[model samples]
Target chain A: MATVSLKNLTKRYGNMEIVHGIDLEIADREFIALVGPSGCGKSTTLRMIAGLEDISGGEIDIGGRKVNDLPPRSRNISMVFQSYALYPHMTVRENLGFSLKIAGATKDEMDRRVAEASAILGLDELLERRPSQLSGGQRQRVAMGRAIVRDPDVFLFDEPLSNLDAKLRTQMRTEIKKLHAKVKSTVIYVTHDQVEAMTLADRIVIMRSGYIEQVGTPDEVFSRPATRFVAGFIGSPPMNLHEATVSDGRLVFSAGDSLPLPGQFKSRTSTGDKVVFGIRPDDFYPTGHGLSSGGETEVHRVELPVSITEPLGNETLVFAEFNGTDWVSRMLNPKPLKAGDRIGMSFDLSRAHLFSAETGKSLRN
Target chain B: MKGFKPSAPFLLLLPAIVVLAAVVVLPLILSLYSSFTPFRLTRPETFYVFVGFRNYLSILSNADFWWAFGRTVLLLTIALNLEMLLGLGLAMLVEKATRGQRILRTLMMFPMMFSPILVGFQFKFMFNDNIGLVNNALQSLGITQDAIPWLIEGHLAFIAIAIAEIWSSTSIFAILILAGLLAMPKEPIEAARVDGCTPWQTFRYVTWPFVMPFAYIAMTIRSLDVARAYDIVKIMTDGGPAGRTELLWTLVGRTAYSDARMGLANAMAYFSILLSIAFTVYFYNKLAAARAQIGAEW
Candidate 1:
């Protein structure tokens, strides 16, 4: 197990600084995921830590040892690539045993480790097959087997499941979670999928434009987003964010629609202050169908004309016009509803979020 | 004529068939037929004298012809292998170059641009025994007291011809292998590094196998080129100094032109064709195996 520390880690290609100075402390065996949109430097930061990309000015300490000048191999970390970069010329057994062979391991040790990894990944039958002969999920398994065969101090995954189909991705996600539990190595997974980050990472580091927007537990980032970006980014159907001016204890939108400012942000936000009001689809649901956050549930009900209703078996997603834009509300024990129907929607103000319009920082102290 | 119509495809292919027959089929048939007869270019009457297997039988017992055949094989073997290794090195060097890669690739192909006959003449002058550049450089550098006969001596002549042949065609391997290197994915190399493979180990295990198919293809093309090697040897040695450095092509050329033994030369030329066929088949099989090893379609 290793604690990875990034102190002012920065990466600049030529004169274009891609990953700005970002510091983070990953505890031993902590599965940290760097999640962001494309070109947000999450991958760059991971690459810098892996030593695949050069760090412009920073210190990377893996297992409490400075590794700024170390090559990827010297750092004793294993990486699973997005393409499942198994050696095409080798069989599955050979692919798993390659790193050991390169390390000059004895034949018995190599075979033992290869067998162990294959058994763990359910690749015993596929040992003789080449990567091209295997399916996408099988190839992904072989890649993970290759990494675990080394028994590295840290495991680095660069969108390893991005290449798999949705069903297989979910299957492999569980396998990876189990694998992480079995190995218990420090993992730094980089992915653009927020759900993958939330499910897999012990802590999520949300980045935007080369800067770390927020770093917290999945629940913390979701329930209490530090920035307006995090609130909209971390959720499945993304939080509904609307620009508003706090006036007379009410958030007034540009379209003259108003919401009573949540009591928690009363001390942080004042009248005439422009802010971005945020609420999740789960928090804003049909009346009597809303879920509680277990604290004081100060919910406000409003009737709005439904624009569309998406029935997803158990629960339906109702899209309705609010503040001159579509605000999605989840209907638990969903009732039969259609477009043009006026339904009372509940807004969970206790779970609501507010961020300054000038700076997207949250107004909840 | 109204009822039995000529096939439309055959009619369309008529001109190409006629041209192939005239240029390729006619010459092959004429040569095969002539090899069975005691045909002499100088005496037109001897062309009809049926010799049956006389030419083939004579060549089987001829020590000089066998020696030339052996020498030709040796030259092809040595030249093609050395060219492949050098070309691989050159391609890797160019691939690693960050800037001016386009210019470097163009420059790398300079030797390939020269006609083989021109290259033969150029090397012939460079390897001349008395006042050649090689001996002059060796003597001036005090590496040799006397002039080293680059072309006159048997082994020296073979080496000189091989060098000239390698110089002209190494770029063929380089260009094809460079294309392979360029098309290779960067992820595998990075993965290799992450898997604890040293740079040399990565090259040995990953890069080399990926490019082996391309190298074999180059070998196949150059093997056919070198198996029928005639121009460089003709220009440089011409089976000189009691035919010590004589190759099959030089011997066949002399027999066909100088001795006026067209039938014997045709038989020898047919034997040389067998050598080319053998090398081509071997390289093609190797190419297929390499492609298969990489899980690529043959």
Candidate 2:
């Protein structure tokens, strides 16, 4: 395993720059996931690291050696593509041993390595089977086996689990995590799925519009978002931000509802400053005795008309409207709340987030 | 039975059946019946006479017929193999070219655009004895002091016909193989490179195997086309002064129309059909095997 460092890494296609001067240091044996929406250049960044794409301007150092000019093979990196990309003609044995054979490994050595990889992946029985004969999950395993047999310094995955079904994706996610743990190799995985990034990454790099929004641990990024984009992107149902202004040391909503600001923002903002209050769906709870009685617990209460209720067995997702803005709240033991029903809900202001309305930057930062 | 009846399909197929009976079925039955009789085109009254396998026996024993048959096979083998090799080389080179590829492809197809008869005449004039461009150029370069008997010599004439045939049809192979190259998945090739395969190794192990099926398909199609090659050879040498380049078709034409021995010619034509069938079946089986190697159903 080796540490990978990208210094001022930039990628441009003609006049339009995709990745704008990204500088990151991935430590050895650390699983760093690059997560973003489509066209956010997450995959492009991984490809540049893999040497599949040329770095327009930057230096990529692997283990203290600059690998900007090196080919993928020379860099000693293995990439598992999103499509699996197994040779359709070769059997699983050949597929796993292809790199070894090309590198001039002996027949005995190839067989040993292939056998070892197959055993690790539980593919010993599928050595003679072609890729077309394998199921989707089995093919995914074969693809991983191909990469593992190489035993490169860095493992690059390009949304490898996106093709599987939901359950299979979850199972393969765990398998990949276990494999990474066993190998202890530095891995750079790229995916748009925040859940995958949250679960698989030791450090998650959230990217937007080719720029790094936030890079932190899952809990850090979830609980302490650095930007409005990260606050809105890293969560499942996402954080809801409503326009508000600080008036007389209190936050005033657009719909005439007023509540005192949380203590975290007391020193950051002055009166009459415009800001946005952000709250996650799960951060809201059913109000008890109104917001005034909850001392030291900064709670803001609001009455909203229920738009829809989605029951997901354990918790119910309640979609409600406030000040013409749709917001979702997760409630425990939520019954059949019909549409147009006005319900009083309380937001936990201590868990709430604030961002500057004009700049889209976190106000608490 | 009532539920199974579909009168619409049968009604729709009625015209096709009638056309097939009139155009294909009736002619096939007539030919088979005529093969049993001593039918001569000039003497139509002889059609009623039963001859059994007399025409077949005559063709079987005929030295000229067997020689022409063997010559056709030789021409087919030489022309098809040369065309395949040249076509494969051209396609590989074209596939590697990044710029001006479209222009090169279009230029390569220039030969295929020409009629076979026109190509034959062009080559014939270029290879003519005294006043031809080839002879004049050779004399001007002092390579040869005298005009070479290009059309008279057996081997030279055969080579000339084969060259003309190769030039005219090599594009068919190139285009088909190029299509295969375009359709090939880029991932395996990239993987092969990352696997440390050299350019030659990648082509040998990955690229060539993928294109073999396409090459076989082109070969099968061109074999049938070249097996019936007559326009060029007829215009160039007309089976030569001593029948040295006597192919099956030329021999059959001489016997059928010129000598008016229709029965013998029909017998020769029927036998020659075996050559086409053999090649078509052989290449088709190879195509199937190649596809199977790639785990494709077709």
Candidate 3:
């Protein structure tokens, strides 16, 4: 395992820079995920670290050695591509042993290493099969096995599970986590799926456009997002956010509905100050519904019309009209609610987030 | 009642079958029939006279015919190999060209754009002993004192013809192989690089095997093309200066048209077909093997 560090890492295409200079330090044996939408430069940063791409500027050090000028092979890093780029002509055994063969390992040594990798990946049965002969999940495993046999200092995965079906993706997610635990290598995984990042990463690096938005543990970013982008991006059914102005100790929406601002944010804003308010579904509940029985709850009473409800077996997602837009609220335990039914709700002010409208930065600090 | 109606597909295809018989099969049968007889275009009555393999036996024994046959084989082997190698080099270079790659590919195909007859005429004049650009350039450069007899010398004329053949058709290989290269998946190449293979090793173990099927396809097509090649050799040397650069097609053309010996020419044509068959079979098997190696099928 090795610590990988990027010092002001920048990538430029012609005159237009796609990845702005950003610094990140990845600890040894840490699984760091870079997650963002397409064209956000997450993949570019990963490729730069893998040395598959030429960095326009800045420095990348892997295991205390400068690797910016080094070739991918000399950097001692392995990558799993989204396409699972297994050599189509070679059998799984040959594919796994290719790097060792290139490095001039003895035949017995290569065979032993390949065997160990195959066993770890459950690929012993498919060792004689070619890539085309294997199923997609099997091919993905072989691709991982190929990297495992190399025993490189670092592993870089660029959306390796994006091609699999949902069920397979979940299965591979567990497998990858297990593989990391067994291998204990410094891993840099890139994905657009926030759930994957939240589940698998020791720390998630959320990127936008060309810059790193925030880097923190999943729970830290989830509860204490540094930017409005993170507040909206980190959760599923995403955090409900809206533009509003502060008026007489209350946040007034464009549609004229107002809710009391959390007392803590009173000092962060003055009357008529524009701010973006955010709240996660779990933090809001119907007064008599799940988690609303706590006597100490400072629930601000509001009556709103329920618009939609997604019953996902264990929990039902309730969407209700509040401040002119639909706000999703999570209902745990049991509550039968349908569209157009007016329900009395209590806003969880303590969990509310306020961000400066102009800067899109969280105002808590 | 519905099942009893005429089958539309076969009915629609009947005209095609008739046209193929008239344009292809009829002539094929006539040529096969003619090969068995002592036919002559000048003497129409000789069409019916049976010759019973006499043409075949006589030609087999004829040393000059064997020399032309051997020379044709040599030219085919040398020209195809040279063109493939040159084509691979050109395709790789063109693949690497970043800006104006489309224009570069177009320029690479320029030689192939010319008709073979035109290419033959072009090379013939270019190889002329007295005033050809090659000899003139050599003389101007003080590389050779004498005006070299390019077409007059047997080996030199063969080289000249081989050069013409390779120059005109190398693009066929380049275009096909370039297409293969373009269609190649980028991930495997990157994977190979991460697997620690050098550029040459990547090409050898990954790129080359993927490209073999395309190369073999081009080879099969070019083999049939160069087998019955006539116009170029005719224009360049007319298989003359003592039939030095004679290919099978030139020999067949002379016998059938100039000598008016249609029966013997047909017999020789049948023999030449064997060469095409051999090449097509060999390349087809190789192509199949290459496809199997990569687990890809058309």
Tens-digit lDDT track for model 2 on A1-365?
A: 49999999999998999999998999999999999999999999998987778999988998879999987778888888888888877899998998898888999999998998899899988999988899999999999999889888889999999999999999999999999988889999999999999999999999998899999999999999998889988987888888899987788999877667888898999898899889888776444422333453666777878888888887678888876667888877656678889889887888889899888889876
Candidate 1 residue pairs in clash (backbone atoms < 3 Å): none
Candidate 2 Cα outliers beyond 4 Å, as residue runs: A288-296, A302-304, B1-22, B29-67, B85-110, B129-152
Per residue, candidate 1 scores C-alpha lDDT tens digits across B159-259 of 99999999999999999999999989888889999999888999999999999999999999998988888888888888776798799888999999999
Report the lDDT tens digits of candidate 1 across residue range A1-365: 59999999888889999988999999989999999999999888888877789889989999999999988889999999999988999999999999999999999999999999989999999999999999999999999999999998889999999999999999999999999899999999999999999999999999999999999999999898999999999997889999999998999999999999898988887889999999999989988876655664688899999999899989999998998789988988888998999989889898888998998999887
**Cα RMSD to native, each candidate?**
1.9, 4.3, 2.9
Please give the fraction of native interface contacts (Cα pairs under 8 Å between A and B) kept by each candidate: 0.84, 0.44, 0.82
Candidate 2 residue-wise lDDT at B13: 99
Q: Against the hidden reference, what TM-scores do the models get?
A: 0.96, 0.88, 0.95
**Which residue pairs show backbone clashes in model 3?**
none
Docking category of candidate 2: acceptable
Candidate 3 accuracy as TM-score: 0.95
Task: Give the per-residue lDDT digits (tens) of candidate 2, residues B113-186.
Answer: 99999999999998898777888899999999999888889888988888889989999999999988888888
* Chain B TM-score in each of the candidates: 0.96, 0.92, 0.94
- A272-342 in candidate 3: lDDT tens per residue? 89999998887787766656546534567788999999999788888989877899988887578889999
**Chain A only: TM-score per candidate:** 0.98, 0.95, 0.98
Superior by TM-score: candidate 1 or candidate 3: 1
lDDT of each: 0.92, 0.87, 0.91
